[model samples]
Target: MARNAEALDLVELLPRYGLENYKPNIEINLFGRLYSAPIAIAPMGMPGMVWPGGEEIFAKASHKARIPFTLSTAAGATIERITELAPDTTWFQLYRMPHNNLEMNFDLVKRAKSTGVHVLILTLDVPARTKRPRELRNQLTIPYKPGLHTLIDVLPHPGWMLALARHGHNSFANYKKYTNKKLSGYELAKFARQRSGGTFSWKEVSQFRDAWPGPLVVKGILHPNDAEKAVSVGVDGVVVSNHGGRQLEGAPATVDVLPAVVNAIGKEATILFDSGIRSGLDVVRVMALGAKAALSGRPFMYGLGALGVQGADHVVNYYTEEISAAMRQIGVHNIQECNNIVIRHENALKF
Candidate 1:
């Protein structure tokens, strides 16, 4: 029953708790993927539109921060390009395609491995496409449809338009060879919707588990039963997410579900969390609740889109500093110490 307003309330409380006096380290491990900090950049699509060379900039920033960066299947750059740019820091996230294209998608996964991607995350919750009104009003579709409205919207932002002209329109570059046609905006969205696996099921999850050789993580999980089922199917980890509250509006905040999901999986599986995590204190709160690590999607994108590479780096550094400060205030030194902290319920109604 977590509301969007509550998420915003927590976001507003972040800056008050600073990291100046805290001497802390925030390293974490996920299926042998060592991170300097438990913070990771969530996979986001169309980064280039937000900032010129968005994926490359973010990847470099992540490398500098010593954290893992995941590349989206629908990102502007190919997985190979992103892996090449970030090397040891890149992971790949898949938006599952229809059953007929499973082999092609598996080939894409193998290609990703060739580029040294160590982890494969399967995003399973986006069965239906969301209609973002702003995007529609701007006529900003996936492979971008350039209508009078779209051109007018672009005319005002000379910087963005200039970048687009220099780099060409932002499209899913990786899928070009497979699709053999150019798409943008609404066409791209329609194409993806036509090709995406709307009927993706648990059986396919099991199939992916057996087929992929690397550590497999199931993202977009919000239910404890789903977490248990993922463990039963041999998933290496489960990311407790509601797709950043973009998919389902009424879904519980990922923080509220972290404890139950961790408890359900026990010590056999890793429990990661995302959604509504805007600052260091929020990261500590989820860690205290039992998350092995935490990630942020829109925050880093905001930094990148608004300030480019430096902005991306600043966001990562800011969170790392924030988490360290929060830990020291609570008398903890490392992520494991977070477990000793407790949540104080506003009212106690149960035994």
Candidate 2:
């Protein structure tokens, strides 16, 4: 599914380099809060596994960039800790719990608000706990046990061990109190399987919207009908995504369905895009198609994995520069005008 999204392309036009007496404005007005850029760091679980202090690095860089850094309930740093690190620049991604644990989930939302999270992203995908063969094979579980396979895998990487020593365990700090003790890979997996609020109907989604009075965003949407439904229920935004192709392998590419979703919802709600954004041009493409902003998880993750904390800074600035350059070349002054330069290529071919 990730490959499918990557396979899609946006048509480019001849450079109109001389037409710019203006600067590119990439500012985003997310829920009345102004941000310097329209791109954000997508929440990835165990970002630190890619590099030590992964969440911290992202937090600092995001703060510097004046963009929201989404903290995953399953990854990055805890809400409380991230607030201390970056204050109001963080957004929380919520994975709804079952009705049996409704109060606790509500409390979790309150806790996030208490920590100064103004934006709440409710992900409505992953209907069931599907098997991920790669993770299973590698035994990448909660509290990451040093099984034979993993032990052997990390044996040669003295740097990872050193970083781990400095940063300590990478368990879900927010969920630590809920569980009795540190859970092993299998134990944690079992718990998640049992507790995962895999899929949600309209009623559940509406309930969440009513509860979260702040900027409420529903991520992981593909269908135009779903986008319309989100707006009808007073959602602040809809993120066109397929959980980065992790939820369903055969699902349509997010970019392919973006136009329909935008047409359905119109400007009724902010439309964000993700799932297979690899370059600054991709950001331009999504915006041209009709997205308020675009996020790339793996590209940023890869940056962190390749260059420690510095890689994160590079990712932000690199993307920013790329967007500005593309805007100039395509003769668009700002993100709002990017769509004007897009040549309709329904049968678009990738370069």
Candidate 3:
């Protein structure tokens, strides 16, 4: 989280004054589709843990706002449901399932293709799960045991409790059907743990590229060589991310490496971005640095946590307005022009 915040804080945009006559355009195109803004809701696991039906709320809002909503494999809503909600804007993110002899992984790919998901993002960052200090401190767990401490935590947030009462517990909505038996909470989490782990090898990614007929992306890329490797393996694009700085404490901030990745393969493959994006100005920063579009997860989650159903749309609108104003302030009239804006980054990673 600190690294992501630094991505925003360490950069300064130098604005030109006389270019204020025209309105800035934030619209962007990704893999042949047009969006109203150069922004997307990054896929997040178990967003319902933040708000009941959080994934659904994001999908609906993304659709209404004409931006993409990438749904995580660990999302609380099913691929079919989120695709139905967004259709034109739905993108599916995948985590390789090494258990069940990889049947579950292929099955997920097949299901996404059948549902007409526009893009398939295979996340490559989580080679292994790492312990999170914040979740540990908060006593938060997958199944959420209600001990006295947890109850004390719950009492202060009556709205959260009320939402939980109405929505029940969040589950791996996609994995439930594959379990072949009714499962909830602990059982479902155990099932997912057994059936899922690890990132994909290049060979595995090539196989997926052959199987899925639409655009394919490999997320969690930080190295220029890895970005070139993803393009070589037939992925349509690469998401330059460090798993939002949630993994590998010593890993470089995504912004620091983004320029190098873009320099290496920006022409051959589409370059998307994630991590540390707290506002639309951050979106402009990455776009100016070379990302084709920016994806954010936490800020919208904050929106949902604070405002409920209205939060998702509010977050989108917030980014939209901020993006426009920031572009104008930087003297850019559109997203492409953002790339040419003058920027100062002392610690940017070089190839």
Candidate 4:
């Protein structure tokens, strides 16, 4: 994760002289609709760990901002509830359930279609959970065991405690109906992981494309060949990511391989980007390299952790202002003009 962030920081946006007279229009068309900007809140599982009702908070904020909000299948909020909150702006990300002949997984897809999610994102990155050294070192386990050490760690944040008290504990609300008994935290995590058999095949993606009525996107693509394969499978878009550098330690940064992926399949399919997008400037950097839009996860999480519900809107506004300012600085009047802007990528991969 740190490597991803560091790699993005190395990309320098070269400023252009003059061209600041016209006010830049940062709007973009995504999922066949116009949005306020090219920024969207990327899907994150267990966001409630940062703030209670985190998914709902982002959904409301994105709706207000006129941008997209993607909900993870393992999110603490349910599909119906989030779609209700942001009917026009909501997107759904799904994980493959290889259990029971994929009955439950197909059910989730059906539910997303019925609920009217604008886009269906099939996440293909997590072949299996990788070792998180920080979590392992901290000995952090879900369904957090109640003890003095845990209490000591949590007691400093009274706001979080009060939020928990009011909203209750977070769980995989989307998958809750599948089990006979109530499960939250670790047990729910285990159940979902077991069902999420991982690394979807192109054939499976094609199956999902046929089943979903709306636009379909395949996330976790890093290689140009994989991007080509995803386009061939009839996906409407592809998210170029390395699972935020969490799944594979040696994987190249998404920015480094973005140009290659775009060259391989940009004409045939929309290429969205994820992993290590920290600012509106970072959004512009990817746009220059040929991403249709930039989906960010960690920056919004940081906002929520600091400011709770207000943080979502705060981040959205910040990105809006920054993207506009950056565009003007780079001599662009709109998102399309960004394609012509000059960028100095010191760390781009040579492939």
All candidates: CA RMSD (Å): 3.8, 3.0, 1.3, 1.6
Q: Give the whole-model CA lDDT for all candidates, comma-separated.
A: 0.76, 0.78, 0.88, 0.87
Question: Which regions of candidate 3 deviate over 4 angstroms?
Answer: none
Q: What's the number of clashes in each of the models?
A: 9, 0, 0, 0
Give the clashing pairs for model 2.
none
Please tell me which predicted candidate would have the highest lDDT against the true structure. 3
Deviating ranges (above 4 Å) for candidate 2:
10-17, 181-193, 347-351
**Model 3 over residues 267-294: C-alpha lDDT tens digits?**
9999999889988889899898899999
Model 1 gets an lDDT of 0.76
Models 1 onward score TM values of: 0.88, 0.91, 0.97, 0.95
Candidate 3's displacement at residue 252, Å, is: 0.8
* Cα error, candidate 1, residue 18 (Å): 19
Range of the 10 consecutive residues with the lowest summed lDDT in candidate 4: 137-146
Candidate 4 local lDDT, 305-341, one digit each (tens): 9999899999999999999988888888889988887
Better of 3 and 4 by lDDT: 3
